[model samples]
Target: MSRTTVLPVTRRATIVGAAVVLAVVALSGCAGTSGSAPEARQSPSKSQSSQSSQSSSPSSAERTPAPTKTTDAAAAATDLTFEDGAALSASTLPAFGLEVSALDGWEQTGEDSSVGSREYTKSDGSVATITQQRITDLDPSMGDRAATEQLFTAAGMPAEQLEEQLLPTMTGGTAQFLSIAGHTTDGSWSATVARAFAKPGAALIVKVQTPSQETLRPDLHDILVHAQVVLT
Candidate 1:
């Protein structure tokens, strides 16, 4: 008869326990891999955060807009008014029926001897003369530019540079101011002339003579600015 051989019970149990333990270890390794997969996916979030930070910052090419520039002529046009400036003394020119003023440091001279003209001299040797005449032949339809040219021509003065100025009068009128700058007829000295028309049929002429235009321009401008037209 053939007989079957059997192993010990403890030894069989030990082998089964080892198999179970190996299966648990394999499942633990799989769980660890699954948890680490979420961590790996988080790397994209960090990369996106870095990109977002870079986009929020200002670029190197960005700049603020610059301010506009204000010119002297433009400033004079807007800032100069009838009320504000240096103190002045008023004198009426009876020939033109208009009033004129001289600023401080200017003394009136050549009173009646000039015949419808008044002369003013400053301590610095700057000279200003004011004259008036009935210009019956002056055509008002030709505009101030033409009148200025005609006046300069008649006075034998060259109008190298002609600029229009706006002078406000106390009588609520705006006189047309034509400013001319050039050397005299003989080219001996630089001079500036301002022709102002406060009324029709007459013209008020102011001539300023100096060694150079630079030295005379300020005084000429000031005199023109302070001129008051009082029609009596």
Candidate 2:
């Protein structure tokens, strides 16, 4: 029998073993790469959670509202109205007692008349007011003249004296009278006549305002002539 070559068989077996080792190593490397893929996907989910938290919070400036301003119409709507022949007495008025009669061609327009002050509005848009108080009520140290001036100023008609005269009263007495020229709260030129009456520990003031001295002089004269003042 011919002898077989032992070296050739050995060489073939060695090559086959080397190929199997390389195949095993390649399969292990592929499995490791696939397991690490989930970690990369988890990084994107963490980033999305952080973004959602930042978007939900609001700043202080975005949550607050702006302030609004007041209008003239709103101020006018709050003014109170009065009826004709409304009266005020020492019990209701702060310092003096008086009764106001309804004047022809004028309408009473304010609630203050029921509590010691009277406001009137004429058809031509003229305004007048009669207010009375003790001299001490205006200022503890003020006299009748100074208090009268202060009253004019407080009523939005700061006085510039035009004349001083004697006003005839229904009780057959004379009251001190003053004619004044000034500007109203709306800056329009105004004329006013004021009368001061003496009482027991108090003084009564009757003031009428108009666009001109001639406009309400007759009304002023009539009001002063018939006004009754009780010494109490």
Candidate 3:
């Protein structure tokens, strides 16, 4: 079986009050193409940055072309595999009514009000999402609850067998935190952590899904916590 992959994410805040659960489905939440390195590209970190880039190049067959010298034109760099470590670009999401200043080299999309999500990416590559949807009622399924069920079902687990905890957020509020750790159907080790919060009218959520890393959970939680609520 193919290795379980945590597809990149880029979303906005959107949810209502619903029961929270723990589960993981396919990484289809954000809905978009992921960033891929350009074909036959070299990493600056490994390249000498100077003259002959021999050691950094691929084998002769993979690097060279026919020896015929013909008048050919040059084309612009097609593969965007090279990353220069640029800073994240700041952006404002009018739908979610928030601004993101921490993003470095990330861009935004999904501006339609109905979607109301601000998706971010770096160098045209997806990293994470701040998906937002207008919340009008109390539906736990809209936040962590919904995320847990969907993800758990996707991975085919006992959705009812997970644990839920009250988590603190940077927004000066509390969120229901839920997580699941087990082997995927393919038998690869996996884990998921999701946090959900609510205010006067919005149901907020932040989910960082990948193989088995616990580093970004708190950071994603705080991001939603501190999001300046401008919804009306």
Q: Which candidate ranks first by TM-score, i.e. highest? A: 1
How does each model score on TM-score?
Answer: 0.48, 0.41, 0.33
Between prediction 1 and prediction 2, the one with superior TM-score is 1
Candidate 1, residue 6: how far the Cα is off, in Å: 99
Clash numbers, per candidate:
0, 1, 31
The root-mean-square deviation over C-alpha atoms between each candidate and the true structure, in angstroms, is 47.5, 51.2, 19.7
Please identify model 1 stretches exceeding 4 Å from their true place. 1-102, 112-115, 139-145, 157-160, 185-190, 196-199
Kindly report which residue pairs in candidate 1 clash with one another.
none
- Misplaced by over 4 Å in model 2 are 1-102, 113-115, 135-162, 185-189, 194-201, 211-216
**Per-residue lDDT tens digits of candidate 3, residues 1-232?**
2121111223444432222233443222111211221111111222333222344434434532322331111011111111200110112111222335433344554443454444443442223444444334434324335544544444454666554433322222222334444434443333343432222223333333223333233323333333322211
Q: Model 3 off-target regions past 4 Å? A: 1-99, 123-125, 134-158, 161-173, 179-202, 208-232
lDDT of 1 by residue, 57-172 (tens): 23323322222442222222211221211111112121222233325677777653323456777777777766655455645455444565566655554444344444443333
lDDT of 2 by residue, 22-108 (tens): 111111111111221110010112254346436842333442232233222211211111110012222221121222432456676
In terms of TM-score, how similar is model 3 to the real structure? 0.33
Highest lDDT: which candidate? 1
